[model samples]
Target: MKALTWQGINELAVKKVPDPHLQNTHDVILRVRRSVACGSDLHLLGGYIPAMEKGDVIGHEFIGDVVETGSGVQKLHVGDRVAVSSFMACGKCWYCKQELYSLCDNANTNPAITEALWGHAAGGCFGYSHAMGGNAGAHAEYIRVPYADGTAFVVPDSVADDRAVFASDAGPTGWMGADRGGVKEGDVVAVWGAGAVGQVAARASELLGASRVIIIDRFPERLALAGQFSEGVETLDYSQVDVDDALREMSGGRGPDVCIEAVGMEAHSEGVQNAYDQVKQQLRLQTDRTTAAREAIYSCRKGGSVFLLGVFGGVVDKFPLGAMMNKGLTVRGAQMHGPRYIPMLLERMARGELRTELFGTHVMPLADAPKGYELFKEKKDGCVRPVFVP
Candidate 1:
């Protein structure tokens, strides 16, 4: 099988690898149809997240056809087109029962690594890292999908592949940000980062009945796309305007009721703090950049909520604990619990409430994944999200 593999820090390649087969009673072998690059993949590409190895396949947001199914798989069979959640969860677990599927106890087969790192393992995600189960990623012709019945959802006939592919990760992840961030009717919501995740987060806020949705980013192209999310959506070019003042003005001098930070560890900011974060990250003193998170916390209204939809692997420096505590704000972060939101998101996609194909700004064959990653990583040619076809 041909798949994209991590060669080294800031390196990727297309190489032939062994094909996958059913590994568990609930597993299924999927012939991947589409897999999109995610912002979080950059962390792996840049060697920010530990436990990644040479030649490891590294993609998780995907849609595919089931090629083989294990005996215990009841809802899926050969030839079914489905979108699989990035997070793997055993449906019978306590966390799964509580709809916090990402915190499932039985998913991460390689638990000791993350358990040692974060005190406990959450769940396994395909192709993320050895710390997240070391499962081969979906950026290939085929992948082994464990817990198929719990993690895979059949794509509705009304939804196209490009649109359904996002339901695998970005859609659910963004929805989680707004849903868990406590977006309410008539609430003013602000989202940091206008990438795919941020775009979706803004749209999710609109769908959740936010009276206004403000998306912040420095890129002109990304901000332009975010502006078209909905009538209630607005975009702020962080390079041109002071985000703090602009958000306060938009929220009637009170700051937004909900703030979502969608940018992850590679988040860029200006000035001395940015330099400090960069040096600390390069020196391995901290594993993430908290610029967006700090800005979100600072910009959120008193008694408001902030949700972190971004992926952060390790400890970060200079988090805004004082403002968060003094303002009586609610702060939460999570890897998306896909099972709890994917079905509803797909239904929304079917109804044309969520249009995500536009996020696939660059489409290419699997053989060209290295170039695609270069374009995506550099944010070159207005690449929002690169979609790779297998």
Candidate 2:
């Protein structure tokens, strides 16, 4: 099988690797049909993710067709179309029962979900890092899917595979970020970083009936997508215009009622030249993903809510916490629990209530992944969300 392997810092290649076979009764085999590069992949690309090992496969969001199922897997069968969540959890864990799937006790107990009897924090995840169970991810011809019945959501036939791809990660992630903001009808919303995730968050706000959606980004291309997603949304080009002024104007002299920080530690801000300077002297692709997260806090309306959906594993510099406290705002971060929303989001996709495909400005084959990462990092226009076909 040809797996998109992350060999080391700033290193990636399509290499032939061993195929994944069933390792446990609950395991299943998936032949990946499609996948995409996410901003998080920059962590792997820049070697910022600490748990990652050399030669690790590093993508989390993907969908595949089931080629085989383990004996204990009853909910899924061969030939089923499914979207795999970034994380896996045990159905019967303390956290899983509470709907905090990331904290699933059983999933943390073992390297492979069904191979052991206790809990470990490392849930079996594909294409993540060594700390995430070191499993090969969906950036391959075929991947071993653990806890298939728990993590893989059966995508409906009504949705095209291109659109269905986002449900695995960015789409639902954006949906979850917006929901975490607790947006209400006619409320004002501001979203930072108009990348695929940020664009979707603004769209989610629109779906929730937000009266105004303000998007912040230096990249005109993604901000344009935010505009296309909703007429209510206004763009703030952080590169040219001042964000504080833009937010004040858009929110009637106040900041947005709800602010979503879709760009996490990967965000770039003023003063910091590049986020990856510690790892290498190269220009940091993660700068936009992290720096934008901090700006959302400063630009949020007083007493508003801020949701942090972007991935930031390490320390970030220049976050203005004093302003957040004085503003009396609520700030939180999250990872999307696909099972919680994939079915509903998929239903909405079926109904056309979510036109997230507007963010899919580019779609190419899996072989073009390295270029996709480069383009996404550069914020290339007409390539908002690029999916790779294997």
Candidate 3:
């Protein structure tokens, strides 16, 4: 099997690797159909997340067909079309019972590494890093899926492969962002970043009854896509104007009711704080850039909620705890619980209520994955997301 392997910082290669086999009684092997690069993958490529090693396969968002299943997998069988969740969970666990699948106690195979860094292990994710379970990623011909009954959702015939592929990660992550942000009827919501997650977050906000949704970014193409795809949604170019002032003025002196930070550790901005963060990051003193996070906190309405869907690996320097304390802001964040939202998102997609197909701006074969990553990372040719068909 040929898979995309991480060689070093900013280095990726397609090479032959051993095919995966069922290792657990509840496991199944999936012949990957469609897999896409995620914004979070950029963090991995940039060496923001640690514990990755040479030759580690790296991808999480994908859909496939079940080729083989263990004896314990009764619900799924060979030839079943499925979308594997990015994270694995045991449905019987305590956290899983609460529908917090990402925090499941029984998934992470490398618990010691995570417990050292995060005080406890959350869940095993496919092809993220060694710290996240070291599971082989889906940017390959096939992958082994554990807890298949709980993690792999059967795709309906009505939903196309292009749309169903996102249910694995991006769609659910964005849905979780809006759901956790506490979007309500007539609430004003603002989302930072115009990537797939940000676009879906804005759309989800509208579906959840937010009267006005604002998306912030520096790219004209992404902002235009957000404006065209999401109804009642507006776009803001942060490079042209002061984001805080523009948001405040747009809201008539009151900040947005909810602010979502979809841009993660690698956020870019122009100013002193960005320069400071860049210096610290280059020196290995800190692993995150907090420009978007700071703006999100400062621009949120008093007593409003700020949701973080972006991936932050390490401690940040000079976070505004004062703003959070003085303004009475509610801060919430989580890794997406795919099992909890994938079904609902699939139903919405099947009913034509959600439009995710527009996100697939570039499609390429598995061998062209290196070129795809280059295009996506550089944002060349208005590329939003590049999907690879294996």
Could you tell me the lDDT of residue 50 within candidate 2?
57
Return the clash pairs for model 3, or none: none
**What's model 2's overall lDDT?**
0.76
* Cα lDDT listed for each candidate: 0.92, 0.76, 0.92
lDDT of 3 at 289: 89
Give candidate 1 regions above 4 Å deviation: none
In the range 1-390, model 2's lDDT, one tens digit per residue, is 777788788778877888889989888898887888887877778766656776776688888999999999999999999988877866877777777665556654335532332233544556777656677888888888878888888888998887788888887788888887899999999888787788788888998989988887777667767767766778887778778887888789988889898776655655445534333323442233356666678888889998998876644445678988999989987666667777788888888766766666677777887777777767665566667778
Candidate 3 lDDT over 1-390, as tens digits, reads 999999999999999999999898999999999999999999899888889999999999999999999999989989999988898888999999999999888888888887887787868999999899999999999999999999999999999999999999999999999998999999989999999999999999999999889999999999999967787789899989888898888787899999999999988998687788899998889889888988999999999999999999878887989999999999998898999999999999999877787888999999999999999999999999999998
Query: Which ten-residue region of model 2 has the weakest summed lDDT?
Result: 279-288
Q: Against the correct fold, how does model 2 do in TM-score?
A: 0.89
Worst 10-residue lDDT window for candidate 1 reads: 223-232
* Cα-based lDDT at residue 181, candidate 1: 95
| Model 3 clash number | 0
Model 2, residue 20: distance off in Å is 0.7
